[model samples]
Target: MTAARSSFGFKDVDAREKVRLVRGVFDRVASRYDLMNDLMSAGVHRVWKDMTAARLNPQPGETIIDCAGGTGDMARRYSRMAAAVQARRGGPDARVVVIDYNAEMIAAGIEKGSAPEMVWAVGDAMKLPLPDACADAYSIAFGIRNVADVSQALREARRVLKPGGRFLCLEFSRPSSEWLRQAYDAYSFKVIPTIGELVAKDRDSYQYLVESIRRFPDQPTLLRMMREAGFGQAEFTNFSGGVCALHHGWAV
Candidate 1:
């Protein structure tokens, strides 16, 4: 039997090969990953991230895992928010863990230095390192599409969360408006890769990134996947007219 095929941007690749290819993509962009984010979305990604965190609303004593959490951007936000809640409520401090398959991305995140509450590990979205029912919340921002097995990743997320644990994902999605989709497509295809070339000096990597976004499942399909993966209940909110979407799931 042949192994399955996965999308590496618009290109179809052996499923087993995608992990290595995706790793290379992040390794090349790790150092300037945050910078390129600012350039690519003109800093709109920041607001989108904020919305993701707000939805999660890191609380006191909650163990939050940011899967494929490149450069610990979301983890840091979680740490701060969780700490604030702990301070006000007078309880155990929350743990914000950053897990990613790419070591270089983890290293870049470490270079920025995070709070003591933050823990960093190199791990896969499809097979996280933590034990079952260990986390109170799990989030992946713009990272799930890179996984060769998104369904497996969803199951792992279900596996690792305690009952009632929340799952949140924020990723680029198909726009609801035809005109906006056309404009976004034009910008994503022509401009983002060029920005990568000028800023990150790696056009091909950013090209793959944009393509991966296009390849990711849109809101409704992903919600169905979540429900099938044992998330009992799931829903999504379109951000910026569906240019991006934030998905929420509850492990029952």
Candidate 2:
């Protein structure tokens, strides 16, 4: 049988090796990850994240597991929403768990005070350290592309979510506009790494991140994967002319 192939940026490698490389990249850049995000996306990432949170519509007393939740951005946003609902309803506060395999990333998140009410843990997306049917919603933003086994991560997401729970992901995608795509490609391949070098002092990590986004599956392919992982009624909404996309699926 032919050997399995996995992507590490523009390079192909064994699946396990790819995981190790990705972990190393994150570990090296964890301290400045959030800042790099802002610089790379020109602050548009915050808008994308706000859109994701709006769609999630976190409710009072619900549990949200944010896998690969580096720096806990989504968790913090969700917690604020949940807290408001709880305060209004006079119920117990909702729970938001931010899990990532990179310990350094989790540490940075905790140090930033990413919502006093949320839980932060270092855990792998493909093998989440959560019980089955334990979460009311699951989310991963800008992190799934780094996973070595995207399908396994999707399966784990489905496993942890309760029946009728929601699965939401925000990720980079192919831009529909040819002109925009060309500009984005130039910025991603050139400006991003240069900024990483000047700011984060890690050009290689940024380069890998950009390449990984290019290697990620497009909108339709990811929906199919979610369906194969037992999610129902999977769909996607592109943002910024498909520069990014929000994918929603239900565990049924």
Candidate 3:
């Protein structure tokens, strides 16, 4: 039997190998991942995440599963939104689960002191360790592109969501303007790895990160994938001249 192939950065490798390689990259940079994000995006990633959470509009007592939620950033943000809703309604706190395949990343989130209402789990996006219809909303921020099989992950996301649940994804996308695209390319290829070396002492991992962003599907293509995965009303909103995008879909 032949093995399936997938991308590890620009290199093609066996699917299992790609997963291992990707996990290794995160393991190497887990401790400094959040810092590197700030350096790479000039603190703009926070704005993107906030926008995603706003669109999610988590309600009180909801169950949100943040797949590949490294360092608990999205989970924490969702928790805050849910908590606000709960306070206004006088309901119980919302439940958030932060799931990551990389144990180091999960450990980093734990060590960083996630919200008391949040739960952390080590799990794969392709096969989440949760029952069907378990979440009111599912989100993956800057993490879906790393999955070896994005389609499978999308299916998994849909599988975990209750009917009428929401799915949100925040990821890098093709820039809308030629000038901005050029500037981003130069920065990504030339500057990001240097910053990675200086801050995380790992250039190859950051290089892989940049390459993976380029390899990810564009906004419309991803929306189609979401629709194909059984999500209804899949749509995307571009951010920062399309340097990033927020994708929304519903399980109806």
Task: Give the TM-scores of the predictions, in the order they appear.
Answer: 0.98, 0.97, 0.98
Give per-residue CA lDDT, model 2, range 145-167, as digits (tens).
99988999999999999999999
Per-residue lDDT of 142 in model 2: 93
For residue 164, what is the lDDT in candidate 3? 90
lDDT of 1 by residue, 79-114 (tens): 988888888878888999999999999999999998
lDDT of 3: 0.93
Off by over 4 Å in 1: none
lDDT score at residue 242, model 3, on the 0-100 scale: 100
Against the true structure, candidate 2 reaches a TM-score of: 0.97
Model 1 residue 66 lDDT score? 96
Q: List ranges where model 3 is wrong by over 4 Å.
A: none
